[model samples]
Target: MRIAIVDYGMGNLHSVTKAFEHVAGDDASIVLTDDPIEVAAADKVVFPGQGAMPDCMRHLEESGLKGAVLDAARQKPFLGICVGAQLLFDYSEEGDTPGLGVFAGEVVRFPKERMHDEAGHKLKVPHMGWNEMFIAREHPLWQGISQGERFYFVHSYHFKPSDDIAVIESAYPYRFAAAVAKDNIFAIQCHPEKSHNAGLQLLRNFVHWDGRP
Candidate 1:
C-alpha cells in the first residue's frame, strides 16, 4: 500500500511514516508530501498533528492540500491522529478556529465540571500514556478489537463526534470520541503507532479494512 503522510509543516510525519513501514513492511511505501497532487494520488493518507488546531489548519490551507484531503476522505480511506482527528470535526473550542468540517461537532478541552472517577481525583490534561479502548460499535476498522482493549493516547483535547464512532465506547474520567469512521473517512484520537502491539494490530486492521461505512 502507498500511504501518504501529509507534510503540512506541523505534523509528526516521520514517526508516522516509520510506523507504517514497520507494519506494512517492504510492500508499503510511505511518502511525506506537501504536494496536493501526490497526496490526492495515494491509496491512503495519514494526517498527523503534533501541534494546535489553528496552525495545523492554516498549514493545510496554505499548502493547498485541504481540498484534496476533503476529496480523499469522501472516497478514500484517510486516518487522522491526534489533532489530525480533531481537525475532522466542524470546529474546535481549542482556538475557536474553524476546522475542515469533515464530521459534525466540535473539539474541546475536557470540561472542568466533569466528575472524577473512583477516588474522586481529577484526570489531568493531555491524557498521555496507555489507555484502554472500548469498542462503541462494530466495524471492519476495528476488525479484531474486543471490549476494553488498550491503546496509547496523548492530547489535551478530544473529539466528540455528532454520532457514535464505530467502537463500542471507551472513557477516561470523562467520555470522548476515541475513534470514528464515517464512510471513507476514518479517524482515531489515540496514536496507534505509539500504542505498541494493540496499536500495530489496529493499523493492520485499518489497512485491511474494506473502508465500508
Candidate 2:
C-alpha cells in the first residue's frame, strides 16, 4: 500500500513520517511529498500541520496540493493531525481564515477566561503537553486503545463540528472536540506520533483500517 504523508511546508513532517515508518514497516510505502499527484495517487494520506492556521492554509494552497489533499480525504483512509484537523472545518477564528469545508464546523480558540484550572492556576494558551482523552464514540482508528489515554497536544484552537461526529473529547478547563471521524476521514487535535505506545497503537490500527467506522 502507498501512504502519502503530505508535505505542505508547515508540519513536523520528519517526525510524523518517521513514526509512520516505524509503525508501517515494510508493509506500506510511506512517501512525504509536496507533489499533488503523489498525494492523489496514494491509497491513504496522512496530513499533518503545525504553526498558525493562516500559514497552514497558505502553504497548502501555495504548494498546489489543496485539491489532492481534499480528494484524498474524501476518497481514502485519511488522517489529519493538529492544525491539519482544524483545516478540515469550513472556517477558523484564527486569522478569520477559511478551510477545505470537508467538514461543517468552525474552529475556535480556547476561551481565555476559562483557561484557569480548578485551583485557579492559569493554563497556557497553546495547551501544550500531554492530556487524557475520553473516547466519545467508537471508530476503527481507536481499536485497542482504552479510554482516558494520554495524547500529546500542542494547539490553541479546536474543532467544533456542526454535528455529533466528535469521536474523541478532551478539556483544557472546558470540553472540546479532540478528534472527529466521518466516513473515511479521521482527524485529531493531538499529535499521536508523539503519544508513545498508545499513539503507536492508533497509528497501527490506521495502517490496517479499511476506512470503516
Model 2, 1-213: lDDT tens digits are 999999999989999999999999988999999999999889999999999999999999999999999889888999999999899999999999999999998999888787899999999988899999998998989988889989999988889899889999998988999999999999999999999999999899888888877
* Model 2 CA deviation exceeding 4 Å by range: none
Per-model TM values vs. the true structure: 0.93, 0.98
lDDT measured at residue 170 in model 2 versus the true structure, 0 to 100: 92
Q: lDDT score of model 2? A: 0.92
**Predicted structure 2, TM vs. truth:** 0.98
**Best model per lDDT:** 2
TM-score of 1: 0.93
- Candidate 1 residue 116 Cα shift, in angstroms, is 2.1
